[model samples]
Target chain A: MPSPARSALAHIAFSDLVVLLRGIFERHGTSAEVAAVLATNCASAQRDGAHSHGVFRMPGYVSTLASGWVDGRAVPVVEDVASGYVRVDARNGFAQPALAAARGLLLEKARSAGIAVLAIHNSHHFAALWPDVEPFAEEGLIALSVVNSMTCVVPHGARRPLFGTNPIAFAAPCAASAPIVFDMATSAMAHGDVQIAARAGETLPPGMGVDSQGLATQDPNAILNGGALLPFGGHKGSALSMMVELLAAALTGGNFSFEFDWDQHPGAKTPWTGQLIIVIDPRKSGGESFARRAQTLVAHMHEVGLSRMPGERRYREREHSALHGVAIAEQELAQLRAMTGD
Target chain B: MPSPARSALAHIAFSDLVVLLRGIFERHGTSAEVAAVLATNCASAQRDGAHSHGVFRMPGYVSTLASGWVDGRAVPVVEDVASGYVRVDARNGFAQPALAAARGLLLEKARSAGIAVLAIHNSHHFAALWPDVEPFAEEGLIALSVVNSMTCVVPHGARRPLFGTNPIAFAAPCAASAPIVFDMATSAMAHGDVQIAARAGETLPPGMGVDSQGLATQDPNAILNGGALLPFGGHKGSALSMMVELLAAALTGGNFSFEFDWDQHPGAKTPWTGQLIIVIDPRKSGGESFARRAQTLVAHMHEVGLSRMPGERRYREREHSALHGVAIAEQELAQLRAMTGD
Candidate 1:
């Protein structure tokens, strides 16, 4: 089964794509500020080839906004809680705007105190997590973030879904290369990827999920309908998911993955949870340049026969997009155009 | 093959075991302060039924000390790097004493700033990581720690071994339960567990490691001899191992797992690397007690049919040991007594 040729795809400049996405978001009920932040995030994901969180999510966003489940125009309230802590109440809005509102204070604290933490609650986080942390690495800092999604993953040794496909994202500066970055879903598979698979009528690998009866199944539809995904690496990943729930939800004073019920608001797709981000200034470390040391690690990784670093593929995709416009299937591009009412 | 009956094992009071182990450490040339910390740490592991890192590690500690690879009496030098960061130069000594020396200041900073980080360099870490973090949770703080060990793991997609069996341990408070705690190696299994299995002449599960020729094998001895372990969950765990190296070693001005060579000193068993610990004061959270939220999460997990939490078994073992005594094989107890010259 050969894929469509590159010539069959539509290509658009990154800026143009962002504009289009922004228009769609603004038209759908989000404030201009939120539309700007979300547009850039989704555009970046698309440019970097993270299609699971790219424009494919636009429909979900539109539907969620229409459902009145989320306050698309809500302004975030940021508090300087402590010398090293910043708290944000997203006012039932998206997490990105909350993070954007607190970014300056978080950066200030990290610079002055050597470390800082941002806790965003009452937020809907539906996009990729890496975008929240990678920028800090670009600023010569280390960042780690976690966000709990809607419950669809079963904890290890548990019979039902209690935990979300909670994801952990990390980024660190490197001297001679792009920042080291990785975003991993603690679940065996991301829910978005599962949806994609179901859409394409593809089967997943074994150990990924089980059916409603708790029998192992590889059918993406079954897993999406009533079954649940498993955590990666068994109990270790499950523990990490539990940690995410504590840090992102409990510590942030937000609803847990299973706490929010959107039954009345049909078409709601975003998880109304919380997020936590920790940033550290590597300049305050006792070591040689943190970035230089990271470069050394990269060199050693290559020497050991590693062909790519964790975020290398994304970087490559980004560069390709920069050189020759962002690639998208023609049909998907048409859908985006329809969404924009342009 | 059935395991030995509990009645066949010897039991000693926790304090008595600590005294015995302390004597062995001091007799092997450690300072009394170092001996006290190491003994309590080891004894706690034994009391918790974590035999892999319990009295079983005493021989390694003594041998490393005898080889003059690590200092036994060097005083740690702590630097108040920032309002939220503390750095410790361990002077080539054991990490526990360094941590003990700075724990108070770290706690104070975390309390003041809502979060703090402690970075210890030039330290030898050879014990279970859980003990390093569980105490922080006991005090109602959340703690996360990572330490990179000697290289024994092949990074995913790499041809050869480059990363250590880096481990991440986390602890958080729960309202009505013992603090939630878990320590896990990024590798398929902890190196200590592999050594214990090899000594017991037991085979490991598949995918644990490769033989000297890089062929998959279940023989634990092969992994201990010239082979290497694989990262758990493939690339995701490998990325975490890399993150541990960056955080624990690179960020602390300490040697990476593969950077230190102990060939000049025979009997060196500990990794001369660094350790990173991040502690957060959950009291600063905007939530209705963080511990209470964690308890709710635990309740939900149980409702989902979770049989036990991550560290429940360890807590149970500790309770049993408190009621009875710390169980140890008679042969091992005799060896410990012999090492103490008692």
Candidate 2:
């Protein structure tokens, strides 16, 4: 039986978290390399202070493994590859491996062709995007990625969930600070936040979600029951969401909203959901000056007092966590411990 | 002097309209070739039913020429060229020539590099973006462009105008039909429309603009009295507008909101704004299969009863206009006739 009482909050070293998480993943059948990559991504998220996407997601990922939804031992294979593009069939593999592999392949292609696009299908969810993009930034390339999901959002005025949160992430190399990364969901709010609110039995901020009858509701429970999520910017956000859905689902030949079995497999449905990745080496265009000009642009923006750069705050958070251990809520750690039976 | 306002509507042949506009532009020192390109863009907009950007903008373009803000005889020079990126200095030249040169350069680079980005500064406003992007789409490429202007909009909660009514345009190739084109302003209503409302002594739609106190108001005059236009989708739209500003202004090294002098030079100050263009060759990725998959996606969307494909209605309008000459409002026709002294 699971413990009703929670474990106390503890300062777990980043290395310790990785070891613990990897052990659990390996025991669940993931290959050592794949488990390590997944754990590294989780740790990166925690270090970046993105608590929602960090270890908090592990309980669900492990649950997916137990239910056989995420094939821990599966691998991705190339379906087709061109001078500037590639298509990968994940073979129901863990998304971290698929994403990492695709990113590497795309960077290689981009080096030669100046730009490369990778379409990945049939993979499990990879919780955080920055980890996938930061590497490209380190390599001095711009990276953009998008993913579609099981429908949990309504088009602008519609009453039913017809689209996914559909995230778009962009990372560009900067001069002084870390790469400027912009990661966002097309929806006003994400499903994870709604689930968190529901679990806490709390009301959501108004305008983030709606009830089953299409009325705006603060109650997360009502929002979860056949309710629809709102777009970030009304029609414009809806338009971008639809675009992501096309690139990720339609382009890669993955199942979309209605086609997915949402009830049985809720980490955004399709046993083989798709994602698209793009990388561009700016040196291929304007040489080193591309980076110089990009840096100048950021400096000009800072001159106007825009507060923080796109990814600066998160990078700072990661720096802080490196100096002082990450904070894990007692309840969350307890849940993870119970799930992994560690 | 203006011939007592010719009230009767007249149907001018589309060819004649093009020739007449071209002739006027040539008379203002623009080269015949540049005039032809500019005229073609306006004609296409008229054909596509976008009157706001078509001939309605001609008088303004010519006035910029007359005021010596736009260098009709000047040509764009490539300031920086990279493998897949280019930056052009328009030399205060007309946008048609600058844009044509930039677009051609980008497309040429994209053919080999897979993708290309071009940024232009010191250029006059280009009237329509579709003509600039459609040619690339015909070759199975995707394109995106953005333009920034003088301050005309308020940040989400601010009362004073602090940003431009920036515009974004995107186009993607289609297999069986015209390429999908979408162009929109970040503001709920454009400054031109607001000016028209104020001139007609009419009120604006609710939520369109705000008064001096940052309160929403429909009174166009009040909104124009030290007030400002509101963004389309509150904070999200504001952020997008800011993004556009940064891309078009900062990246292109053009004047920004606080730096613009809209009234003083009319042509010199804010007239030489910035623009960015991107072209992507899809064939470099999925080959013929890409187009086929895109068709399937469009079909699925149409099956879902979405209003229409991105550019379907516009293409239809163009077809209708090609068969039968376009409708020209009497007042507008008279204005054109007077401008040309016909």
Identify the leading candidate in terms of DockQ: 1
State the DockQ of every prediction.
0.87, 0.28
How good is model 2 by TM-score?
0.86
- Put down candidate 1 lDDT per residue, A232-261, tens digits, no spaces: 999999999999999999999998999999
Tens digits of per-residue lDDT, candidate 2, B130-168, equal 676777777888777778876668766454676778877
lDDT scores of the candidates, listed in order:
0.93, 0.70
Superposed on all Cα atoms, model 1 deviates from the true structure by an RMSD in Å of 1.8
lDDT of 2: 0.70
- Give TM per candidate: 0.98, 0.86
Which residue pairs collide, candidate 1?
A: none
